[model samples]
Target: MTRLTALLLLLIAIPLAAARPTIDAHLHHVNFLHDSDGLETLLDAMDAADIEAAVVLGLPVTKKWEEDAPREPRYYMGDEAPVYYYSAADPLLIAALDALPAAQQRRLYPFMSGFNPTDLNAVEHVRRMIEAYPNRWQGIGEILTRHDDLTALTDGETARANHPALIAVYRLAAQHDLPVLLHSNLTSKRERSFIYLSELEEALAAAPDTRFIWAHAGTSAEIHRHQGALPKLGETVEQLLKRYPNLYVDLSWTVLEPYLLDQEGRPDPDWVALVSRWPQRFVIGSDVVGRFGNLGNIMHSFEPFLAALPSAVADRVARKNVQALLPGQAAMPLDD
Candidate 1:
């Protein structure tokens, strides 16, 4: 093609790239042992989706203990039946990133999550890793406290967000200026009600210095009890956001149906206004696990909702908000 033609094509391609640039505040590094794909898959998917940066956390607790348990296809959360677990200290995630050249790693903001929250020494476990690879680690968690179905699947002693052991972990995170991405389901997973949020409120109150990302905006996976329609959680979400300046919201796939969009894939005006009220407090997360077969379309899944938002509000929630939180933001590329 001629230079003039090539330039024209380049100009056209840029707008198709990112209607609004985005930072995936939440995503996972698929462990190749049990998953369909791994780090490279995620990297490629992120690029295709126009996701500029992603916060990748390792699974903190593994299901290795489920080895002797008989598999029951009828069990709840069946896909998560615990067969094997890579420990909280597993080097597999870091190793994969280490294998990549510097340019590739820049697109990823890795966080340390593979630590036992209930262990008294959990604080030390995270600290040692952070110290060992100071530059590699930017945040902590996706810490599973009240997560549905998976709660029983874990081998370690279960603890709530406000448990003493976790309190210590949060303190350690604050000391390092590492933001903690907590996955304490806002309400009871069974009841789908706002009963358990106080546990989160307690944790937030205790760790005033820590920046906490409330994954799924406290929403959990849908269960049989959801009764066809879920509660409108926008007001509850606003209350929490209003109460905690240190808190940020992760609007992951778990909340796509009830919290942000409707059955027709359109944005809810109330939800949009709630998010727009504090656009900086919210960020988009693909919430993909161990698979990138569809990651490219995950962030774009929110396009209709984003389109409904004011451009400035949409861009902030999509990209700039999370960018402000990243530790190595200065080194990341700003180009399409």
Candidate 2:
């Protein structure tokens, strides 16, 4: 083709490639301090980003603003203060959802994330939240288990995916037909192997009936900050997906740089192939914590990867799969 024709073709393809709608399957409505921009602000962000729906989660842990600190830290990692499990996170989210009308509420799927994953009472807490809200709580998690720095900073016994408490929680999720969105890192910041893989595997095997979305495919920003990337992640994820029929991968921002996108920001061929191989088992998420200003950028960053896949597969990852995992049949009124 001539240079002008190629340029013209590229111009035409850009619009088509960017046209996919999205559902953020792993968004956090409250930050570490249990603060948020409210549901209306999030709705505006979603509209601007072309996001049709979202799985809204609350941070179960909150950072303490110690009196000795120079100034109050707005984020968890701002200081050496220990984080504690904050059960009020759920009520805060519930208040936000209740403030909005039913139509606006449908756009957001709130998951119960306040209880300590290591506490046996966590199972009962999840049950109460679900029963109290009836159809309000769709799933359980963004549950912090085996996280990198966050784990060390949290002021409690470490939460593991396979903890007896979590196994019980997983059973509760299955009973309610709710998908659990879990954040268990595959490996630690220093170790290269899948040290925590078995913990996650145990959880999966313990409650085979429960559906789980492995956040960031078991990776974290802190892990990447230290190790750059997990070795053989695609192969490991594929292996897990093959083994667990209920397993679904959450392709959030942390996986974008080294796993899904190449150095040039183009989609990595291997990931595209894996996603195409099992289209229904994968979904994308913003993973934005308590802030919606960057929501559009976070969602749009996946466009290159989404465009690289077959249209049907791309659509599933971008929008359909997460919707299917949601508990209710509420009408998603996007245009409203």
Candidate 3:
């Protein structure tokens, strides 16, 4: 091979190799039954896809379906029958992550969950887990509230972000300097209205110190299931970001599909501007629940939308911003 040809190839490879990882900030490692995937498999998938890191959390709520509710949720990926209620406990995640080798452990950051959010003691429960895995625990949540079918199936009062019990939990998060990832759907399947957004805004005001990762930007599959009139969330999100400096939006697949993309599958220029305007306030998430088969593709889906953004802004939304939110010890180094 000629020296000139090889030199040209090296120059092209250098920039590609140094590109940042597309972090999946909202993936689920555990659901009702248990931690379904092994850590090594997940890491290998990330490596193949060039995902530098991900925020791994167990679903805190176990769903209990009504007798009439179908055994398998229509959109669920796992082969098992749909869980009527998500099993409650953090042990699955804790035990799963604890068993990982030191090097593999560095690829994923663990977030505490597996507790009832409405319990006044939710904060203490999460705190105990944090203390148990000092270097392991980085954040708390995927806290399910006003969830679509889950809320419908739940027998008791569904927890809201503004609820005093959750308020207490936020206080605990603040004390520990940990970020709280909240999944409070803006509306229920039944109502199809923006009734619950006030609840979220109130909570954001109450705990000014707590950094929140708002999952799905209030979009959920249940929202689609009922197929009722919806609020213009894009405008609402812009306002919320302006109002709450502590809040970060998780642009998972739910939003990535219709909201962030145009009918033609192009990145909505408006979204590009919103992200670029507040580069540090937005992060991308795969929203994969207890499944990693498509992990790489899920993270990769955001690339086209990201490509529409400016270079530096694209890098921040892709990985760096979310890494900043992770605890110093648990956050991974950037590819650059």
Candidate 4:
């Protein structure tokens, strides 16, 4: 090749190589609790996807659904079917972490949650885990919100009640300098119900030091269908994101089809505009439930979303923003 052509090709390649981001902060390595070799599969997927690091989470088995028969204590006591419940200290999690490649191990940060948040002594439990593996685990949340049985553990007042114990957990997170990932959602005919934006504002005021992340952007499938109703909710979320330096949101579950497109099948500019405004406050999360079908779908879906954004903005939303929230950690390449 001519010298001029070679130089031009090199320049283009350099910019393209430097553009890829380096982290996915909202990964869930739950198979560690069940599959003996789950961490291998998790790491393989990361490597395949060119993901540099991921924030892992552990939860009791209550989140799992039984297909054929009863095996363990059912946490969803209502009309919902029985599902097994396990402790956060389940051996699988520790084993998976132990088995990971040292580089991949450095990339994994753990968080703790349970179906019955109140019964688990969340504060004490997370404190112990963080104390034991200070570098391996970083924060806690993804706490269940809808099930009545689990909600009862938080005193039957809904996840937003800020019950004494829940407050204590938040306080503990603050003391540890860790961010709390909340699973608050916007559901109901009214603009707010399960966990209102107002309630979150109050919580932030009460615990200014505690970093907060609204899992799923606080948007649900049902809420997304009523696009007209979201302006108020969006306004509230926008206000919170602007008002609190510690407040953040996750884009993991927020990209449901309805929210991404209108009835006519066109991209919704309003939604895109809202997300773009606070790119720094959002993080990439698959919320991968470990089921093969779910994992495959999430893996396929995120690419288009990434492709839609400007490279600089996507870099922050995909990884850099999360790295900033994680205290004491320098930003790393998403695909390193």
**Residue pairs with backbone atoms closer than 3 Å in model 2 (clashes):** none
Model 4, runs deviating above 4 Å: 1-22, 31-37, 61-85, 89-91, 114-116, 119-121, 146-158, 189-195, 222-231, 261-267, 292-300, 330-336
Runs in model 3 with CA error above 4 Å? 1-20, 63-88, 190-192, 228-231, 328-336
lDDT of 2 by residue, 86-136 (tens): 998888889889989899999998899999998989999998888788877
| Best candidate (score: lDDT) | 2
lDDT of 3 by residue, 148-203 (tens): 66655444577788988889888888878788899998987767568899999999
The TM-score between candidate 3 and the true structure equals: 0.84
lDDT over C-alpha atoms for residue 124 of model 1: 82
- Where is the poorest 10-residue window by lDDT in model 3? 2-11
lDDT of 4 by residue, 1-336 (tens): 522223324433332223344465566665422432266677666665556677777655443444653553233443345344455543445667787667767777766664345443756766776676665546776665543344443333355625455677778888877888876655543444544555566667778888887776666544544543355555666777888877887766444344544444344566567767766777767666453223333433444455566676677776687777776654454343
lDDT per residue, candidate 1, 1-336, as tens digits?
522233324434444366456888888775323343767777777777677788887676544424555663333255555522345433667887888888988888888877777788878877788877766788887788876667776655666888888899899888877888998876554575677778999999999988898998877655423543356577888888889888988888766665576654568888889887887788888777678766656666677788888888888788887877765333122322
**Which has the greatest TM-score?**
2
Off by over 4 Å in 1: 1-19, 31-36, 65-76, 79-90, 223-225, 228-232, 328-336
**Full-model lDDT for every candidate:** 0.72, 0.86, 0.74, 0.59
Q: Looking at candidate 1, what is the lDDT of residue 101?
A: 81
lDDT of 1: 0.72
Ranking of all predicted structures according to TM-score, beginning with the best and ending with the worst:
2, 1, 3, 4
Clashing pairs in 1: 88-114, 142-181
Better of 2 and 4 by TM-score: 2
